[model samples]
Target: MFKQLIPIALIAVCTPALAAEPMVVQVKRLSLDTALKIAQGSIAACREKGIQIGVTVVDRDGTVQVTLRDTIAAPITVPISEQKARTAVNFNAATSAMKDRANSPIGRIDGLVMSAGGVPILVGGSALAGGVGVSGAPAGETDEECALAGVAKVQEDLDLAM
Candidate 1:
């Protein structure tokens, strides 16, 4: 019984050591110029809709990539755009999805924002980069439309392989 117990203990101790390491997927990085272009496209889309908006892009880690605040945009729109961009990168989902989840109990956490205008930059099904965020628009859908348009521009510009 003692020998059997010793073997069991050894097996338990060695099991964790033999376990495989967690897989880490590397996300592709978007160049600063490309990030700016994406933001610009988003702004253009909003402008075409007659909306004065602030656009912000962030990296996958939620760091600011480019920020474009229109001259006529509301002051609050600046931070709101940044918040939406951060929300998208942090959550790895579009701002619209974040908004939907925000209405849920779990979304009430201290640092989450669920507003629209945030979109994730994805490549090959992997969230390799971040996306454009538009604010100073009347509705979430309007903001989302602009953001999606911006993403489309980036996709078209790069002719993304994905």
Candidate 2:
């Protein structure tokens, strides 16, 4: 009885030590400055083509971080641009490619648009920082180009900062 009681005591003492603790993770996210820069870059790209457009930047959680609309852009562009950004971040893929999958199981869900002009911003080794979307271009391809330009404008900054 004494030996059995000693083993039980030891087991009880060790059980708490073996218990798992919740993992703590630190994530690097997009900053307001970076989001603004990307949005502004998108706007500038469209301006360079003499087109009025709206741009939106969304965080990894598909929350809008920054939204900029050109003075001449149509009001409809605002929501369209925001949706595009949300779509990109939701899938971690370019919205341009998702266009072909609009009817597929993975597309056209969660109130996101699978059209072109949305691109994801990844950092810290595949970590999704956010996304940028541009709208109001005459063509989806043009919109995508402008979005890409916006990403390029701040690519170096993102890479270095993270």
Candidate 3:
């Protein structure tokens, strides 16, 4: 009789709780439209700052999603900025941080660039997409700041805290 009662009690406690839970799906990355919107936001921020920046956004694989260059920005800023964004995404760290390390002897051994700009796109602590890179600003740090602005804009759009 006690064994039968225990099973009944367990079912009573578990059933309602299970029924109350909502179904969930794990989403890994932003949609293409969302990604483009993120890029646009970054560009807007850069423009507002009066910085002629070139911005590049890539997927986790370093594939370009949306790229924009201010009318007065240099053409060469495009590829280099893209590379910075790609490097950050691939390593899951800011490109500027990596570039700083690359400037060191150990960094040389690792053969990395230690410049500013480039940030990783993470969702749920996982790298879901690539980040934005800005170049043709006043300095490397300026590039990074704009890139960060872009990242933040996208994160907000996606309702992500990070």
lDDT by residue (tens digit), candidate 3, 72-121:
88998888778777777767888777754675675553323457877777
- Looking at candidate 2, the ten consecutive residues that score lowest on lDDT are 18-27
Kindly report which residue stretches of model 2 are placed more than 4 angstroms away from their true locations once superposed: 1-22
Measured against the true structure, the TM-scores of the candidates, in listed sequence, are 0.78, 0.83, 0.71
Q: How high is the CA lDDT of each candidate model?
A: 0.80, 0.88, 0.74
Clashing pairs in 1: none
lDDT of 2 by residue, 1-162 (tens): 898899899999998876765468677788898888888888888999999999999999989999999998999899999999999988899998888898887774767889898999987547799988889999988988999898888888778877
lDDT string for model 1 (61-117, tens) is 878889998879898887788888888878788878766678788677654568877
Off by over 4 Å in 1: 1-26, 156-162
Candidate 3 segments exceeding 4 Å error: 1-27, 104-113, 159-162
Ranking by TM-score: 2, 1, 3
lDDT for residue 90 in candidate 3, whole number 0-100: 69
